[model samples]
Target: MPKKRGKKYTEAAKKVEAALAANGDGGLAPEEACKIVKATSTSKFDATVEAHIRLGVDPRHAEQMVRGSVVLPNGTGKKVRVAVFATGDKVREAQDAG
Candidate 1:
């Protein structure tokens, strides 16, 4: 026998299904996706948005592996602090840059 979802789980599933129905299972523009996410958020705290991408490269072969980093256009919603250890010119450059 299959287990049944509780009332809360069922209600949440309905909400998700409704959202999916309203927004068809097609590729959405970034702005449109953000709007949908914000409208559906039911928490007092800010919600997190994530993306999962599948690349056409083989990971087993070291030569075919890919690595890179990107800076988000709007910046991540987190604070970062920089710490540097240096002497003379490097220390002066860091202090001046700050």
Candidate 2:
């Protein structure tokens, strides 16, 4: 069984649907989506943003497995420096990404 949502959730869902319709198939820009989310927020506590991705891969097959990571633009509150060690092609790829 699934839990029922409250009025706030329903309103936010409607706003999301409207934004999707206005943006058409291309979808909303990252900035626009953020604006909509912030505007529709009804909770007093801080809200979190996340992503759910689907890919074609078999977990049992090592060669076909996929893995990746992303860095948040707002960052974690602490300040820190990051380091990466790579060899050959990866070194070049990291440099290019930088």
Candidate 3:
């Protein structure tokens, strides 16, 4: 139990604390507190750190995704190719957007 808690919590706590503090004062009312946090903490990505925890992934995996190495793992069995299709003018947009 200690091993599980130690490995998971140690990696997650600092980032979570910083994110919460950046969101708003932790003492505020629940609804108001959540609203401030949500409004302040928007990322362009569809997924978020909290969602990863709710989905039961280890925080180390989350850190890898944040650091961009998770998407490009050399040891993964399959190589992935991403495709984008658009009108003639949108090719540059696709690359820029990624």
Candidate 4:
């Protein structure tokens, strides 16, 4: 059986839906959406945010794959986690460098 959503989860979903409805344009500003995400997050860890855009390409066709990134002149302030994978003395170097 699938797990059921809790009261808090249900309330958060409803809140987000209402907020979206209030935006008659059917779109939320990036800042406003971020606020809602932060407000409705009940996890102990930081919430993960993802955005989807349609490019009108069939993903099943490898030739139509789209992948690239544009770095902003001013870096985003989001925290990033780095991993140091080494099997030998390099591990010690990573720790010392940190």
Residue-level lDDT tens digits of model 3 in 1-98 = 44555554555555556667776855444565455455555456654433212333565675634333355354668766889988877988888877
- For model 1, the superposed segments whose C-alpha errors exceed 4 Å read 1-12, 18-36, 73-98
lDDT of 1 by residue, 1-98 (tens): 97987775676667656766777864555676566667666678977779655576899999998999999998988888899999989999999888
lDDT of 2 at 12: 91
**Each candidate: what lDDT?**
0.75, 0.83, 0.57, 0.87
Candidate 2's TM-score reads 0.48
Local error of candidate 1 at residue 67 (angstroms): 1.6
The segments of candidate 2 whose C-alpha lies over 4 angstroms from its true place after superposition are 1-4, 52-98
Clashing pairs in 1: none
State every prediction's TM-score relative to the real structure.
Answer: 0.41, 0.48, 0.21, 0.50
Q: Put down candidate 4 lDDT per residue, 47-85, tens digits, no spaces.
A: 668975456799799999888999978689887777999
Clash tally, candidates in order: 0, 0, 0, 0
Residue pairs in candidate 3 whose N, alpha carbon or C atoms collide under 3 angstroms: none
Q: Write the per-residue lDDT of candidate 2 for residues 1-98, one digit (tens) a residue.
A: 87899988988999999999998984777788889989898879998878544465788999988778979798877977667799999998888877
